[model samples]
Target: MSELRKKWITAPLLKLIKKVLPPISETEREAMEAGEVWWDAQLLSGKPDWDQLLSMGPPQLSEEEQAFLDGPVEELCRMVDDWKISFEDRDISPEIWEFLKKERFFGIIIPKEYGGLGFSPTAHGEIVTKVSTRSTCVGVTVMVPNSLGPGELLMAHGTDEQKQYYLPRLADGREIPCFGLTSPEAGSDAAAMVDRGVVCYGDYKGEKTLGMRVDWHKRYITLGPVATVLGLAFKLYDPDHLLGDKEALGITVALVPTDTEGVTIGQRHLPAMQAFQNGPNWGVDVFIPMEWIIGGRENVGRGWYMLMSALAAGRGISLPSLSTGGAKMAARTTGAYARIREQFGIPIGKFEGVQRRLAEIASVAYVLDSAHKTTTRALDAGHKPAVVTAIMKAHATHGLRQAINDAMDIHAGKGIMDGPLNYLGNVYRAVPVAITVEGANILTRSLMIFGQGAIRCHPYLFEEMLAAENPDTKEGVEALDKLLPKHMLFQVKTFIRGVFHGWTGGLFANSPRGVGYAAKYYRQMDRYSAVLTLVTEISLLSLGGGLKRKEQISGRLGDVLSQLYLLSCTLKRFKDDGSPREDRPLLEFAMRAGLHNIEVSLMEVFQNFPRRFLGQLMHFLAMPWGHSIRTASDRQSHACAELLMEPSETRDRLTRGVFLGNPGDGVDLVEQAFNKVCATESLRDKLKKGGIRAFNREAIDAGLERELISGEEAAELREAAEAVNMAIQVDHFDHLGTRES
Candidate 1:
């Protein structure tokens, strides 16, 4: 059986785990049942509901949709591989777009009856990601229309006539569509839009015009200048109350012909160094006929709601696809580089230091690759996941960026310079695009995945936070408001547990790994979470969303969450192919490195945290096997292990003080060990002492030089030269100090 299969079937461990933990209170249980933790808490906090989007209507498609997805995916993969290089330097043209239109690339998500590919989310995701591998510009172009533009909106809310008229033409690329949602004043704050669609229902004219009035100015729109159609959004104003009773009830979605009388296409903006053919589009005072109202005249003032649903689906389509492509480039370059580049007559890959980096890069690349594929499969499974999509967008992009950076480093000078040969160094320069695009990292980092997903991922924080604050939840809270009181009670019990566990050396108390090596990090994470929960509740009481709120729990919690998620991703990738001899190093190294990073991160959080703990707090909160520590110990046991594998006595860095070097030829024993020692902190530090420095060179010439020359004459040799020789000889150390005496 596959390693992943074994891990996949680990149900019994999880069940055993739940039985030992404290049972969630009834109030908190509601949060658990709801599958959200943070946002619900926000609602309970009485924060204004700023979200303009609606119930993301079911994202997963039906079997028919699934059937539609397959063919497009395969074709897209082919196109990507074929156009790989042109994509690197952002090489493409109008001819390419025209060819894409001719090949029906523009219509994958349109309904079949509409003359498009009629593919499902999964299928669309597949095509988009595959193309993104070769060129993300292509992927974005493929994603925009099918996902958030005229095609999705019309399919969801357009009138029968609207779909019949525009769908077929859109599928055939006869009318490319761009959705205008973002503007300078309105980004995350969509309700703040100043642009309005005013009504001019009745005029003293012998003419007939039936629908609601429309006017808009939009920028940063994809497919803007080139599109034959536009889906515009504006605030609904009812002077005659055409859109229900409320003056401005909802944002509205309107289909506007590109050639409308008041509409004017403006200059394009290309920000990402992508193909200019498919970048940003702009327009001013776009006006369309009354029949252009999506879902006819009935759905006015509901544009925000409509756009949200589409954006959610659209995000799942594009960003993840781009990240996947970047990952592929990272793996391709690193693996290719490892196979070639030689130093000291051996491939640099032969060195353990270089090999470790290569392994990590491989591990990350594969993990991201698998995530992209799996997320696509889930999309194919007929379900759209808002949080999952967000997570993918955040994590996958990060992985690609890190992997590419590592790839660039591995290439060193070769990567930094522009070369005649086609390579990933250029791709490395483009790393910021993915990170900055769709959403900025700080926003995504601070608010989106964790800030938003905390609601989805937490077990009790959601409901309890709400119940504690609201009178409406009085009955529910009354039954289980044991929240604050329970936390106090739990801490006492926790102290009791901690005392017993620590007294017993914390062997096999909680967590997955038992005592011997696993008692350091993972268990500490558990401890940290338990402590943070009590503090979080306290903050929820004292400050709601005030100053003390952020301090209740640090971003470290989210960071841990992020690490676990990524490590899980890495492990899954490490296990994808199958267990084999060649894979052992990669798998073990990835797991060990992941565990070490998490543990260290946890330790750092502990150190800088305002809360004080015994300095050895890390010791009590050990890992499953102290994996990093244990790996170092094990490597030490193996004589064949690299000199760089040992931990530094001073500080830690990725390279472990071992220079990324190739040992030169003709090295002697003392020279070799001495050279390695100089590379190491311990020996390096030792050489700095008074006694050591005093004898350093002169003594080396008197005592050591004779060994290199003749036993009798060496004593008469110089001492100053010995120290220099000793320093230089470390790489070839054995050649000196051991000569005939």
Candidate 2:
């Protein structure tokens, strides 16, 4: 333990702070007792360990996996159109549901031995991204089963018998599974849940057996309406001590059959206009045998750990995929729409204002896609990056929010209009649902990412804290003695690196051999990393235990950490994807943007420090280096916009899986129209010079009649007009008729 840890353990200041600060809640207490350190916790120690990350490489997809994505997954996404089902039927059509079940869409993550397709995390992400681009409702339907639900929980913690019974049923979709974790009162603070299960002898199927009588009220459960089995998390109580002496066994997870007596399921919630089976469920006096307990009775009271672990594996995959999908869709569609839609006789994309937004949209899409791919690779490598997942979920959704807003700004009225022809509206409406789920962006940022991460990721911090709280004085001292020397050395190294990098602009930091401008980005990241380490140490030492209560400061620190991780991913992506020259501007923009955000976060940390003198001192230490960081230039923005304006192999690669068009919908009509208009540029210029600008169908016919232009010019002009008309079209639906009268 460093001096900070020593002080945290034995200092009078901590003791004083503990008294004045709010007491730790049950949730916090439970988390401490669980005592598992995650990957993010290690990174928070301020050391950049690139060996594992760099060595992992990009996620690989086998030929069969690729074929599955291109075949059944692609076909399934096309079949469930959000526009048709959202307002009219309010759920996926029966045919689509049956197809998903038969194709085992719900079992992508289960093991092959368990009768499901055992796919890599990368493949799972690809499937969700492709599906999300077409319909969020379908995406949620697919994601819930594969993510933090019973299937995952069972695989990780189920008894052999439980696995033998449940996994196959779940894998085959013979049992539709939904996990009830979030309650009406307990959202983020799940330890505060009121639902309870009591151990006692209860009549089950007319036989007296030792079981738990559970009563639970859960809301916002995905697939609740149609689920046949629900994985329920509740507080388990044993007042009679039927099996153990403990009265309470913390939080416990159990598999509850939805059709059992006293179980009520299927009260639906219409989230925005997008429809999926999301609803509330409750059970009164529901009896389940001890075997139903996940991981058997041995794992009782460990539900929080199980849920967190399950989330660690799957959380980083799903929502980030959805967000990246939205970004790709927005970039692809808005780029084409801006070119095809004309205002003042030129494409709206030509305007500088629109170009700025387009640049942001493209940049966001690129960065988010890069982050998603890189993080998923980490997951596939067997690292459960809990903090990374939290950061990705919060940050990617935020990026998606910005990308969608920019897309809407560029599309103007067309984006706001709700219809099948309007591609951007449904995604925009579903923004809240994405940001609010998994973990709300606010809590994830302010608490989970940095709050838990700072203690968890720091090399000696968790050990030191655990030792301090340990009852045996000799053991605590021995542990601290073991860690203290290394911790002190780490602090010394951090100090030297900070001063050296800060003074010389990272000139001494090792840069990869033969890399070009990206080398400077790597160096800049080094400088920021040094600064981040120094500040994190200073903040923890200065704030002590009270830092947990200071959410604003914690959130800013998280921002700094998250930006660094994202920048790292961006650089890795540039290298992993063959370092294409066309993507240089995007890479530049992403780096500058990340550095600017880090600088801002640093300033915020300094500004919000509880100790004014310490804040000023730290700001002085950060000095000219911190203040000198700049954002991407307008020229870079223009270059990014230009990349989006014209269709190229690069643009196509970036937006490859985005759903542009399918049969029965004119989705690609805009791209087709833009291509046609651009193809006849010579004729268009001649007509414009001849004072025949803004030609509609009638105007083109009139021009032909008067011989203002040749027959060929008129014919091409008519084609452009018709294509534009179809491209700008929006659907009209009868809202009242589609609803209950």
Candidate 3:
């Protein structure tokens, strides 16, 4: 591989991340000052609550907690699972939506006063998980209105009258609200939206331009076909030179009854979120009173800000909860099926390869769950975490995609087919869209997180800085960019300093696992924080002339930014939880897997750009995976070994992954274990139908208990894995503080 290519594939910078992680306090405010990771508010200071496990106490299974957790998640699982039923029957039952709404699913996000559940983010997540487990379509419909629709807007900015008039009806489904934002020319670029309005001033001066004459077309509107009221976003222009009314402002949100005069919502257009009611709603020259503005007349021309604040919380809730639940459901179903489905006289679950993935799927499920909860709590705390939400959306979705995929791998031929056996396939098809929506993961990371952070999270002079950059003075505009770098660099240096002060501050950081998770935390923050800054500057410059171009840049930024946010959240949880593995099992697992994934996806995205820029694509494609990235290879291998211990015939199913997997690891271990088990036909045949329990029973019969791992074996495993990992690190040139190759 080329030197740059090596850097892209390996993870050398992991060292730096490890160094910086311990100092991160319970508050992420420190990251803002040191990382220049700011926006919207003053940067916070202090350390993270790294000793979370201690604070949380042990992972004891309370009877109530266990019961709640173990309850028929099947009801929830069927939501996404039935897609297989649909493809097999080529249709779905109406019971899907009915089953959800009747369960009070529709009311989860609405406040209790509004005749709804008035649930918190976690509650909403649980409901979505249930919906997505059986059907992502159901998840989509259930999530849209309650989480991101009119209810969110009204709560945030609506006038008392508006909330009182609309929220209750919406909660009961007596009136369904649809948000009209994206237009034909705008997909990810909402600010460049083409819809606009001219104020309708009366000939009388007292009522100058209190209403607007609007024209616009919007597509990809969920519930558009069935909406009773439309929350429309359009630019407000001073038509007839009317300036007194709020309608004279530039951009505004208006709630229009679909039946109002001069208003018409068009036909339903096919959209990829095709499972439920989805369509495009268009309008031209629609007349709407200025009172229709969300949050009332006081906040006109501020639609973007209003919408964005609500979306941050909504995004965190939707994809993370839905995706995590879906993945867990898929894994649960697939694992059970693999255990029961026999081949070569043994069940598939006995295979080491399958075991490895199961472990990973389980690990991911928990991590995603924890991370989802963290973000939800943040929302409940009223954090309004813009950057954090993006991260949750991207990271959770990415992990879910993998968890579902791992299930498919174990399912093999059964998974590949479009039948009840291949239940995981339908949700898998939607992987890309999940990542692309809500500003796309790219923009969430690369632009919005850091760009917004630089302005929002700075210490001391954040407000002055924002004012400096956005000053009305021409000189201020010209000099602000230059002033920004000095302050930004100072923050970056603080981050470096804080990293060194870690663990020295406490016993937790010194613990091996705490160290690992902390390392991952800082490494990720450092790796992307700078690149995000660069992308932000460039995007801002690009937008000076071509305002819309920033949207595309924003999308790219979102992807990188989203990854960073999720990774940080994962690290925070891992460190705080105090897992006991040598490398801090949970922490290490999250890191190795997260790093490997982020790197690969980053590479794919980076390489997707013009190939001609390979030599010096500094401003273009950035490196993804590098040697600094950590590896959970040791754990993965151990788990895989357990999975491969099935019968010989079941071993055949693993043939595909072995060829596709890394060449260095002893790929034959799984197959070899299978053959050894299958040598005795009688034993293999007996275990085929229920190999997992049977094999596990046999292990008990064999008396292989209390394996603390001999020092010799531990040394050998470490030697082998460490060597392999070292090679990867060197090959990827990860030592350099670079994000993209």
Candidate 4:
């Protein structure tokens, strides 16, 4: 230890820091301590190692995973009639339920030894996404058990006995599992839950043994009504100090069998009328053995950490996959409808307004799908990536909302009038459910993403916090002495990079070779990353603890970080796919949109910085040339929109993994019309050149009579016209909109 340096610098600096450090609540500290940071740390570094991202090989599905997706997944999608599930039946048919059990759909994330499919996270995500396009109810059914449910928890932190017992049951659907975390009074603030387990002797299975008397009421629990076993979170108290010196054991998670006495489980809440099994359950005095505690009694008071870690990987998969499903469904169906349905004697897709909407739909699908694939691969590679997972949950669900809104706007009448043929109707109603669950978008954006990200991703900030908090005064001061200089150097370098990159538009920024069309995007991302790092440091320095209360500022910062990650994923997707020529429009749209969003977010943060002059200065440093970037351009939008309308390889690749259903369904009809339209595009163009603008029986017959088209070509044109007519026709009900009622 350098005694002279410590006496001169560290002693006084530590005293000032202690005076300034905010009082961190137990909950906040536990949250800050949970989950590992990965690529997010690089983006926050301002000098991301481009090679690190490139070194992550392309995402791929194993042969077993691919076979499952092709086999049971596809068959399951075929069996779900979304309209009937949501409206008439209000549940998947009993047959489908049995099919889920037999196929181990609920056990996708469990290992093979546990009798699960033992699929990779990517496979799990792909299955959920593919099924979601068919039915949200079934998707939720599959997603819950695999995600933050008991299955995931048990696998991660279960006792050996708990794993051996519950994992196999959960895998084969012998036990339908749901985790009860959210209570009426403690929704987002789960740590504030009043659910309690009092330590005491209790009777169990004809033997008196050590256990706890638990009482809890939990709501908004997915799979609750139908679950055979339940995972519970509650505060444990040892008023008698039976098993601990402290009365409070913090939050603990335990497994409770639904058949246990005093347990209630047979009810359901209609979530947006989506027909998923979610509702409240209560236990007046449920007694569970000490061994029932997840990871056993030694792991008490660690429930919050366990839940946070589970959510880190789970959030990256389930909701984002579902969100991407909604987006791809919207893109495929809306594009087909826009192409086949005529307005003013031309495909409505030709309208610029519609094209704009279509562009958003397709691009949102593209970006969200890319992120879903990329993030799931990270999970598969054993990276939890908490901050990035939160970003995925927030942005992907928001993207779903945006894409569905555009689809509804385009399908105005069809979307508004919900019926059997309204493919977008059920998904539209389910948007709010996705946005509200996992974590509400408002809270996730305004707080968690950047609020948690800043300390977790920063190289020295968390260490600095720990150093400041160390109980030994001399040790704390010494730690700070070593860290402070490095921290200051990092801030200086970040500021320089921000200014330099902004002035030059990131010309010499590090980027991989063969990025081709994405080289400029990579450079801009690098610039924005530096700008974000610089502004984040300045904001912290200026606002201090008060920045936590300034959610608007934090949210804008979170937006900047999220856009950088999404943009990186988009570029990675392009490179992984060998930068296909056919997919360039989708890639370009995604990159342009992501970079534009980054610019807007950075500008917003700078403009809203607490110090007005400082804000202005940072703004100029971020964009010295008066706003060099704009939203995705109209030409890009046109190209992306046109890509959606036609039956192109790019469109297929973008919209793949969605359910096409039977041959006569609404989506099926749309598909038929789209293909027929493309097939007859040249034939119709030939007729157009012969002065037939609109396809009609009369026009086709006249063309054949005039010999401008062959008889076979005339038949093809007539068939195309009929297909379009059938596709654009809205369903009319017999009575009350159901056939069997």
Q: Pick the candidate with the highest lDDT.
A: 4
Give a tens-digit lDDT track for model 4, residues 1-741.
Answer: 489878877877776665665556777778777779999999999999888887787778999999999999999988888888888888889999999999999889999998988988999999999999998889989998888878888999998999999898888889999899999898857668999999999888889889899999999999899888889999999999988699998999999998899998757898887999898999998898999999999888888888998999999999999999999999999999999888766899999899999998998998999899899989989999999999999999999999999999998897887666789988988899999999999999999999889878999987877787863488788789889999999999999998899888888776778788778878888888888898888887777777888899999899989988988888888888888887887877777777777777777777777888988988787678766776777887898899989887888888999999777888888899888988998888888888878778998998888888999999999998999877776766676555532
TM-score of candidate 1 versus the correct structure, residues matched by position: 0.63
lDDT of 3: 0.54
Candidate 1 — which residues are off by over 4 angstroms? Answer: 1-91, 202-216, 276-285, 288-291, 296-298, 416-420, 458-543, 547-555, 570-584, 593-741
Once all C-alphas are superposed, what RMSD does model 1 give against the true structure? 16.1
Count of clashes, each model: 40, 5, 82, 0
lDDT of 4 at 695: 76
Per residue, candidate 1 scores C-alpha lDDT tens digits across 1-741 of 533432443233223323422233332233223222222232122111212111121135466544434444444444432223333444445565666777677788787888887776656765565556444566667767776677888887789999999988888888988877666676644557766767655321346555555555677677787888878877767667664576765567787777765677777665455543333433444444466789877776556666655555566567766666666555544443443344653335456676666665655655565555555555555545555555566777777788777777776765554322324543454467667656665566555554444544444444444443333333433423344356456545545543443344334334432222322433433333333333333323333433123432334444545554444443333333333333444445544555556456545545554435532453344222233323323342121122222323211211111111122221122234333323432322233332333223353343333343344333322222243233222111134433221
Best by TM-score: 4
Pick out the ten consecutive residues of candidate 2 with the lowest summed lDDT. Answer: 13-22
The C-alpha TM-scores of every prediction are 0.63, 0.94, 0.66, 0.97
User: In candidate 3, how many Å is residue 615 off?
Assistant: 13
Candidate 4 wrong stretches, greater than 4 Å: 739-741
Candidate 2: which stretches are off by over 4 Å?
1-47, 664-666, 689-692, 698-714, 733-741
Which 10 successive residues of model 3 have the least lDDT summed? 654-663
Comparing 3 with 4 on lDDT, the higher-scoring candidate is: 4
Question: Compared with the true structure, what per-residue lDDT tens digits does model 3 show for residues 668-737?
Answer: 2222222333343344333333332333333323322233233443343334333322221211113453
Which pairs clash inside model 4? none
